[model samples]
Target: MGASQTQLRETLDRLGLTVPLADALWVLDPAQPAPSMKTLAGQLHCDPSSATFLVTRLELQGLTERVPDPADRRSKTVELTDKGALVRGELIEAMVAQSPLAALGPEDQAAALQLLRRALAQAERP
Candidate 1:
């Protein structure tokens, strides 16, 4: 979904969250399986200290928890708790509702997604 910075900020405020924390939640997406906390830090472009802070906040809210990485016992992965999933859903719904993309039907949204994917692919090219 599309949204302006102001909208995002407002939404986060309504959810009692900050911008970085919201971004962390989005990156901690359940679709890709559990990505390591290091990966999460990289995705957020934050230092280890910042990542620790974000994780602490998430844990305090019972939204996400650190689990032992399946591939590496020494590492941990961030997994969304059931409560986190529901909250994430609410955030997405709020964003979508505030976005112009909400007016588009499924077919139109799919076409938009296709275009965005193409744009992203092109942007990634050297």
Candidate 2:
């Protein structure tokens, strides 16, 4: 699908996130229960070195912080800072405001959301 890169760029610009796609993905997964550099790398299908680089950049920007896992001194966990939370909230609001759901009639939007929930149910498959 050749979607609108222009729209995508404009949307990202509105959100003030200049990171590339991989870093964007990392930002989106901020609320995972136990997020880590390793987990992010696995999700992005990138190498550990690349993941580290992404994490370092985000950390430098103050969007994320690496805290030592209290239970394991050798391990660390990644968590979004207050700034990240605010950015995520704004991004989500912008997305919802621009999405087709708002333009669709209420009845149609409800039906579409129901189908989307059903599609979400397919996550059980391996």
Q: Taking the candidates one at a time, how many backbone clashes does each contain?
A: 0, 0
Task: Tell me the lDDT of model 1 at 25.
Answer: 85
Residue 64 lDDT in model 1?
A: 93
Model 2 deviation from the true structure expressed as Cα RMSD, one decimal place:
3.2
Residue 64 miss distance in model 1 (angstroms): 0.8
Residues 3-86, model 2: lDDT tens digits: 333335576676556545324444545556546667667766778788777777767767667888777768776777887667
TM-score of 2: 0.71
What lDDT does model 2 reach?
0.66
lDDT of each: 0.84, 0.66
RMSD of each: 2.3, 3.2
Using lDDT as the measure, which candidate wins? 1
Q: What is the number of residue pairs that collide in model 1?
A: 0
Worst 10 residues of 1 by lDDT: 1-10
User: Across residues 93-116, which tens digit of lDDT does each residue of candidate 1 receive?
Assistant: 777787777789999999999999
Model 2: runs farther than 4 Å from truth?
1-5, 18-34
